[model samples]
Target: MTTNVLMTVPTGPGVGLTSVSVGLVRALEQQGLKASFFKPIAQPHPGDEGPDRSTAMVAQGSSLRPVEPIPLHEAERYLYNDNIDELMEEVVGRFQASVDNDSTIIVEGLAQIPGHPYATRLNKAIARTLDAGLVLVTAPNDMRVQDLEHHVEIAAGSYGGIKAHDVIGCILNKTIPGSLGAKSYGDQFARRPIFKRNFALLGQIPVAEELTYPRVKDVAEFLRARIINAGEMDTRRIQSYTLCARGVENVLEALRPGVLVFTPGDRTDVIMATAIAALNDIKIAALVLTGGYEPSAALIALCGKAMAKGLPILSVESNSWDTAIKMQSFNQEIPLDDKERILNVKEHIARCIDHDWINSFALNHEERKLSPPAFRYRLIEQARALNKRIVLPEGEEVRTIQAASICAERGIARCTLLGKEEEIRRIAQNNGIELNHGVEILDPDSIRERYVAPMVEIRKHKGLTDIVARELLQDQVVLGTMMLEQNHVDGLVSGAVHTTANTIRPALQLIKTSPDSSLVSSVFFMCLPDQVLVYGDCAINPDPSAEQLAEIAIQSADSARAFGIAPRVAMISYSTGGSGSGNDVEKVREATRIAQSRRPDLLIDGPLQYDAAIMEKVAQQKAPNSKVAGKATVFIFPDLNTGNTTYKAVQRSADVISIGPMLQGIRKPVNDLSRGALVDDIVYTIAITAIQAGSIGA
Candidate 1:
């Protein structure tokens, strides 16, 4: 299906919807997607034969050709006369004409205005009629969470009935940086149970001063002022306006770049001081003279010198107070000619919006479909939320170093690299990789003495002497494990340059399994094109008994749920529902029964072939009554050989990215990466490890 997105604001009126809409279209186009712009109904602009200001701005700012906007007067007339059917028919026809099979069509909706009590209903109808996914944009004001939830519910509702599925996501617009609205909701914005909303919480757009500032020309035009001395600075931006009613000395202190100085035309002292400030490289935006007065001949000549240096001077009939009040109430619209401001708007949007989610949505519009990028994004987001430290024992490896840099750059984890600081820096410099600020490097040899006694005291019962403990502590993995055991670090990730045994042996000896766990098992998060699947007992268990297999299934399901993937487990086998009886099939059947007996709340089904476990058609024919047959997210294998081989096969054949061999059942978090893992693989593994550490405390 072609990508069609309808952007509407919830309780708007300065919600910054126009800028966001244009920015989204531009962002999509920048990603090499052909995106078109359409405004079905637009506010009326004076003497404008073309599109509205926002629509025209998008056309001028990007390559997207503008479609004709339905005039506000015509739309209001149609609605007032109760001819909505005819209105919708014409609107749908116009939208279809603008749509292309290959290009994405971005439809802009009406802003919150008077006489539009049914704005939400009208927008929902338009989205439904256009078969477009609705994106609700809301700004941060005095709105509480309950108010936002009510607004979302209302936006999802239509005139006829509720259609929550019509809404794809919501955007918290113009949020203040570091405010509660920006940090509180966070990555859990969509998943919070209090909201009871299934739509994606795309992200928050912080208040950008550049986007909020109005251009000098726009302000002048809005106030109906006459330009006394015009130059090449008509496009200068005004961040704030100031009244020059005070003395010249007081006004001089308040003068700053982007400040539009407002004073009476007779205030020659203030006007001359401002002109002098402009000439001194203070860079004032413009000068607005009130009281319908113009500068005297000598004063005009003095102002003409500054105007020659590219400063605008305007004269208005209203006094300073009235002018200031009018300026405050003026609607801040990005002028079509202000290309720099428009570019700033687009860039701000590109940086703030959820790029991974939107890119995935553009490619595939299915709800709840976890695209690979979005899956990786969620992992990083969760890890950043935890902000836990993870030790990397294979720090000398190039991939480990690069992965640490990435994790640090993304704030995914605080990575402590176990290696000589100078040596790691040399390797990083030689490889042309810059370490991020969040990465810490330590020499394992330097920390050996402090951990020797602690290591010996723990393993003294197993005949480990101080000398032996000191020697073992020299190993990077051992030292990292000691750090975890002593609560110095939150988690550990190793094995990129070493074998899996080299990584797991130290954790098993020092960290040990949790009291609830019978044995430690491993699982891989297989990121498919459409979803993330968990493959369990893949690396740890060699030939697990039914009891151990059941434990692995339960652990895998719990791990899946912890990471935000719902746990619908399918105990995989060579047979479906006793179609063939064998030791392997019987083992899977027994494990399924045992797992169900232990955790009755889990959605688990067993003794099903691979096809019957995941393919809906095959599941219907083979295990029709099974609850988790066709939608299994966690796959528990009977043995390690079967699990490992199947996971690798799926990974290679389908070109899927598999993260982990994440060791479950551990008291603290310690994971082993594949020896040949890529940089991204290590990054995600560290993130997963950090998240596990957060769940279990330090």
Candidate 2:
């Protein structure tokens, strides 16, 4: 199911609606759900660039996939000619085709510009058509408290007559920093009678100067200037500009980083002083020559040398005063390739906005269906509900450090990296990864002695000696596993830089299997577009007898339910219901009977082909009388050959996201990663491990 949220600007433009929309989409994605963008009624194109700046911004800033925006002329023509019904139909159809069942679509409305007299009506109509909820975007101007309340009341009343189109909340965008001192605007608005009864005042966002500044490239493109000396300064951002009509001494005092200087091109003294400042490592964003004047060839050559040191010089036809005026009024649009600014904006929004209330509101009011994206999001949320300590043995690996940083930043878990503290810090610094997010790095050499005695006692029956224990504890994985055994950490995730055998052997030797489990098995959480499936015995247990197969099936079913997937067990084979008699088919049939007898509450069917077990149409033709033939969330394979091959095929060919080799039946939570895992792969693995620890206790 799709949750549709409509964002409308109640007041005029300059309220940062596009920035707020992009920020909200990112926040939703950070919460672990797939969030997409849609613009049913596109705004008029800005100059020659294109229509729908909001759509382009969202596409570049977030991980959501882009869909081509609907053109503005189509909706304008239909609305102008009084074809409202046809307009609504066309919009709804296009929106349905753009998004899938897994994503939550954030629909942006039109800007409150002139000639669009029916903009509010259009927003209300589209929200009603899509059965979406409404969120009003308002900015703080020179209006008083009563005037602000009146404007909000009118905006909320626009949706009063629509059925099921509720106004969920309002965001106060671009407010002054300390205007609402000692009390947030949300709390103040909550005390107001009109706003309290109508909709929730979500929170206020302070105006960020970084979002308002134009890059040097933006200024150059807007003024139609010629570059005298172009270098690596195109991406430099200009916070403000200065008109250098003063003396060279005055200009020298005013020169600073990110300041654009606009002066007559023939002012040799000013030009020489600027270049000298740039040579001394004082970087200027750019220099604009006004009045179409050019310096002498020798001076221009000298400026070219300065360009190599990172100074951009541009010449424009306007005079110095005119150039300053044009720069002041320049409309700053974030370029599609400016990733640094996009990241800055996202970080600012995450810190300033009240995402907890917004997320909780969405979860409570939206549809209660579990999509793959929503399932992953719920896992992170569940893991954060009770913070658990997770240890990473491959601490010096790049992917491990990056994943630990993300986990710590998002509060997914409290992570501990096992390595020398200095080496971990050096790796993080070299890779530009931040480790100040509360992630701890410990030196295993300093703590290995404390765990040697415990490890020897635990393994005394297996002929382990104190000297051997001390030597074995030198390995990071073994040390981490010993920590788990001693209750120092709740979970452990390793194997990014080590072999799977090396990672799992330590856990098997120390943690061992749970008391109720007969054998340990593994499952991959196959995340399809709409749902998450479970494929079991893919990473462990090569071939087993009927009894072991039955135990694997039971363990897989329990794991499926623990991770929020309803379990329906299917014992997959090459035949259905004794249609073909073979050793493999008989083994699956016996395992199915044993599993059913052991757990009568579970829905299970056996001896079925893969197609007959998963496809409803094939099940109707092959095994119509079976209960678990058509819809099975958990698939129990006959052997590792079938299980491993099928999951890998689905993961690579069908483009499904598989998250494990999550070892079940272990006494504690210790997950092994693939040798070629990405940073995100390691991150979610840690989250899953933390949740498992919460379920089974430390």
Candidate 3:
């Protein structure tokens, strides 16, 4: 398994590295991509610089496996001896040992701390050695909204410019909430022009108010006070501490759940005030004595009901001022058992990230080779062997002329350009195209009469009208379809300047659906960097019924098999399994059942979400114990609305190339090209048409 690594390098010591790491893992998992976590060298845990809590926290928190880190001292010793190469060797070796194939691994880098003088240099070197993509994790601690971006710009320089391909993006941690420049977190939305630059802002985690409080148990331990009444010590969390040296009348107003009170033990009024609130069920966290003060026997007796109601009171041995200063220094750090908060943090931060970028990153990694698909190689080979004649209706269109020229030159097909011979020649000459053998430029004017009688005969059922047939023959697409009906051309490809209706209307009238097919559907061969996937009914059905959808699914599976793509058909829907329901989901479910029952030979499953269909990790969680859940290659959308939108989104987001809406089930091959298709797209559509032409006879 060749491992792909994304090393998350922090800007400094406290950038919420663990929180960011946990959230990132969850985000990837939510997208159905498998991600693992690794900390190469341990960093400081709160109050101690030993035994990493980040690894332990994430390991316990997520299902993803986390590799334990080498002790910081051992790693630093290598730096001290200047044997950086050996240290890198150790890091990479240990990292690769834990690697899994086709899964992304997130390596947490050493923080830029006072202790680790070579942390930055080591991080870059380790990243380079591992051939890892770098993701910068930053925190705007003291830097204002305007200045925070400069830190990212500076840190990214160590790796490369921000736009460098290996620099994945940046994740901003501990962001203050509010409007931009409004103190803490502001208008840092995960929108375009993210971060006021071209910098990729993957996520911006808001400062959570919940993380500000330490558990009451932790506070009790830190203060080293005797717990006279240990009410809800382990369960209760406290923040917003107040030195309640004032009278009961003033302090009573602030008594609330999570507010810690510090008052003199002799302040019976304050104690009574707290007891009153407790009796009223205000849920005050705890009451602490400052300056070694403890209440008298009568006071303790009086507060028995309050203590029973679970209000903790602690007596400390320091002066009020001294205890106040110590409490002020206490930190609000995460404890291991707070699973609910940990999960919430993961979900919150995951929601903040730009999922589109992460999905693209995952897809890019999945198909990183960036080579022509094997199916494409097969396309040219098969089309060339058949040597079929492909008729282009939009011959005068610039792109069509170039495509026909290429087809003729490469022997991909015998090209028949239906346009004015002289006009076609002039257009080719102006475009610097030297056209030659296997290319036939027919003047549609001369051929218009030859196809009029055939058109009239074919459409005579609609209405016998020679006048109408001649008028219809003026349309190049109608002319092309008529030529295919009479076996004058092996295939017809149009729609470069026409709508889908224009391309199909003529075919339906003349060369309609083959006897073996009930419905005429279309599919696009999406070319990823490594492989090809077939998206079906995208350009054809708007909202097919369950029965028609089944037929479409079966036809798509057959088409994919014909095109050399293994057909594990996934019936795509908005939900996975029984997780969602509605008319939409029910349609997909019925389609899957009908298709599976009709074509038992095909591997088919449905009501699968986009991620469940392609990603094994998500499949395992969402639709596990089912066949064709994760390894589906051919996707049958329930309707055209979903199919078209999803295909375009995936194509643009993943930077994929797609060909066709190659009209299937037509007796003779007919395909449509997008208006915005390039010359190369037309050429491939021609090849696909030729292949379809061959499939008809076979």
Index of the highest-TM-score prediction? 2
Write down the TM-score of every candidate.
0.55, 0.72, 0.51
lDDT by residue for model 2 (51-143), tens: 356766676534455566667788878878999899999887778776755566778776677777878888878877877777778876756
Steric collisions counted per model? 0, 0, 7
Pairs of residues at least 3 apart in sequence or in different chains that clash in candidate 2: none
Candidate 3 — which residues are off by over 4 angstroms? 1-3, 49-51, 142-146, 179-199, 296-298, 361-698
TM-score, cand. 2: 0.72
Q: What lDDT does model 1 reach?
A: 0.79
Compared with the true structure, all predictions reach lDDT values of 0.79, 0.79, 0.79
* Candidate 3 C-alpha lDDT tens digits along 445-536: 88889877777777777885889888888888988888899998999999889998999988877888999888789998887644578899
